[model samples]
Target: MRFTTRVLLLQLLTVVAVVATSTAVFIGLSMAQLRDEAETSALMIARTVAAEPEVRELVAEEAQDEENPPAEELAQGQLQQYAVAASQSTGALFVVITDQNGMRLAHPDEDLLNLLVSTSFSEAMEGREVVAWERGTLGESARAKVPVFAPGSDTPVGEVSVGFERAGVFDDLPRKLLFIGAAALLALVIGLIASLILRKRWEKLTLGLQPEELVVLVQNQAAVLDGVGDGVIALDTDGVIRLSNGAANRIFGILDSENLTLADLDLADDVVADLEGGTARDGVVANGRVIFLEARSVDRGGQALGSVIVVRDRTDLMALSERLDSVRAMTSALRVQRHEFANRIHVAAGLVEAGRMQEATEFLHTMRSRGPVDYPLVGVELITEPFLQAFLGAKSLEASERGVSLQIREETLVLGNVAEVEDVATVLGNLVDNAVTAAVASDELRLVEVTLLDDADQLVIVVADSGPGITPGADPFAHQPKKLAENDQDSGQLKDHIHGHGIGLTLSQDMAQRRGGEVWLVEPGGEKSRRGAVFGARLPDVMEPDDSVNYREVQEEDK
Candidate 1:
């Protein structure tokens, strides 16, 4: 049923219940009141008749003499006549007078005259007045019995009985109930009208949405919000969080989704203000994850309803982008090497065709002595591992193109292969690229030094450049501003856009930290250290094989 209809029905039932209960109580009380009034009037009439001097004297005479004649019983007849006149005038059913022995002296029914009363008169004889419901010869009535006292005496000589018919006593009730029923009916009609009005108002309040529609809306909202990977948060105009999806709750680290606001989450004020203001913020970090944020204001009929915030996590996308950049750099270096090798081959071919056979042989010998065409750098050969050798050679080519000399330290010694080549590559790639940039910008001869060490438990990488060291009072590893570089176009976006400026170092540290390792500046760039800022990365669980264990085994056996 529609909500308004249900409300109307509920109100109707409530009013009916109240009216019915009230009517029942009122009917009972009214009936009792009317009956009591009848009894009181009857008692008053009886007492008045009994107080007459002539009636009391006659009753006293009748109690003294039992035998009497119709013609001689003049005083007794007078009392009977008076009672008949009183019964008629007062609208009583009947009025009777009896002696102390309970024999009637006067009765409305002439045939019942001079006979014992057909109802109890014991209380009246004992000098007490009584009023109650009783069935006599006159039928059931509200009757009263009072003692007939003589002049100037409290003692009773006889008794008077007065009765109002039971039917007559309830005659006014139907009329009274008619009024009551009419009032109740009118009240019910008014209540129904009020319920209908309230129903219409309720319809307007709920925008005419039925209970079933609201149910469907809730179900659909849950389905859409919970099924999507993106986080959604809806807030009221007052900035109170009204609805939060499962993704939002999980992303914001909220323990409870209800009755929460952005302030409750202790978010940065600028972020909260931006969200409330319907401004979009991109690449925000929360709970150690990168989030892309979009805010939209919701309005209906030109009224501001609230705002909705959509959040997309960019952490994985950023990692993938970083890997792609590394691959692209490698590809670029390979292209350069291929072009250089092609030139050398062309020269050797030309030399052979020109009849300079000895020189061509010498050139072939020189090229062979130089090892692989891809491994152009002499210092890179110190690291015999093919992947690092190629990676460093590629970086060397990239550095040389930028007028920066990139070289591997002579003391660098890594015997076994790196366990996780990607991790080492990512950290080393970022460090080398950043060093190259710093070196290229320096006034002195651009030079960068790279050192690689595998100490059985960790792979340690250090990169130092001959350039102006880290800026004063700046933390390269910490969060930095996203201010656009003066050469944003030329410099391009770094491998880690999430970290903004100095992204290379920040992302390198993040990647290193993820592998139970750390990357930090071992030395800031200054005169104190000849090499500019020297950064070191210690990656755990990524080391060459344990050759020392085998060496120890051999030594033990010999012993």
Candidate 2:
């Protein structure tokens, strides 16, 4: 059967059982009460007859006789008349007067007069009263017995027995039982009707799906929600998170998402607005990660069902693109260096061809003393590390391609090699990249100046650009770009894949903050003469100490 049908059947059965049991108990109690009433009336009639003065006098006169007389003698006597009168008046089945010897003086049946009574009357024989249900010659009945006292005396001479026939005792009870049965039937009808209504409601609520189908649907939903790589957040119409899978929790770096709304989450305002408006947005930073989100409302038959957001993480992809940009910049610098070498070689060849060996030798010596100058960056010889040299060189070449003069300040100095070069690159590269982009967008002289300072084990970097400086007293990190749809003009690729205005900067700040450092704005740089924005960062424990243990050895040993 269908789910609702089975449920209705169960509910109906339950109601039926309950009503039936209650009706049965009520019938039992009613029958008991009727029996008690019957017995009480029978006892009251018996006592009334036993206390009758004429009936007592006659019974006493009969007891005075030494020999038992034939019941026919007193069958028409006053004792018989009283028994017959009491039986007729009270509607009892029989009213029998018995001597103390348990012999009946009068009975409804004249044939039973003078015979020993069949049912127990011992208690009544001792001058006491008794009431009970018993079976006698007249069949089962609610019977009572009471002792008769001699006229004006305390001695008991005889007893009076009164009985209400079993059938007669329950005369009105049939109507009561009939009413109870009718009520039970009505209750059953009501229960069935209620069950049918409930079944209809259940069908509507479940869309008429069977239990097995619902189970399969739930399993499918679980698989689809949990098996996907991208994060999915399902919300109710109230904007409360109803469902959040493992990927979503992991992406947001939270342990639970129960009952949390968009405002409850640590999301940027632009991200929140996109979610609330149900729009697709890209390159929004959340929890220091670049995530592209596509949000849309869910509805069915014009009923608003709420909203859903699919989040795609792009941080790793952006990082790879940045590395690719670095490689491309390095490649361009190599081409420039090769072209310069060719010119120098051409000059030497011309000197040698003219038989000026001395000039050629001096030129070669001068080149050797000049040291490696492949990088186009100014002051390339100040730093000794090969990685930083290549990195800054690539950055300078990149800046030059965009018409910006990228140079290290004259005061830049360092005491030791950068210990965590990758960390240094992550923080420094972001600041310099932002500065270069800002300088390119400036109306002032397109120049970006970088300075590096080493104090203890900390490395400080500052990048100033001739951009339209930040607003006064405004947080530079406050602005978030909702989406990046522009293409990289030079590379014929979507630049949104490689960068976002706030995303990279947030990641840089997070990495620095993890090491007890910070990135801050030194100068908003929109003053009359200042003309540009300057950003600074301090990264601790990134400098190699003079007497430090070998980090590589420890890593290898741990592995």
Q: Estimate each model's TM-score.
A: 0.71, 0.81
Tell me the RMSD of model 2 versus the true structure.
6.4
lDDT score, residue 45, model 2? 91
Q: Give per-residue lDDT, candidate 1, residue 456.
A: 70
What are the C-alpha RMSDs, in order, of all predicted structures? 6.6, 6.4
Report the number of clashing residue pairs per model. 1, 0
Model 1 lDDT, residue 421, Cα: 67
Worst 10 residues of 1 by lDDT: 488-497
Quote the lDDT for 102 in model 2: 78
Kindly state the number of residue pairs that clash in model 2: 0
Report the lDDT tens digits of candidate 1 across residue range 301-345: 666778888988776676667777777766776777678789999
Return the top candidate by lDDT: 2
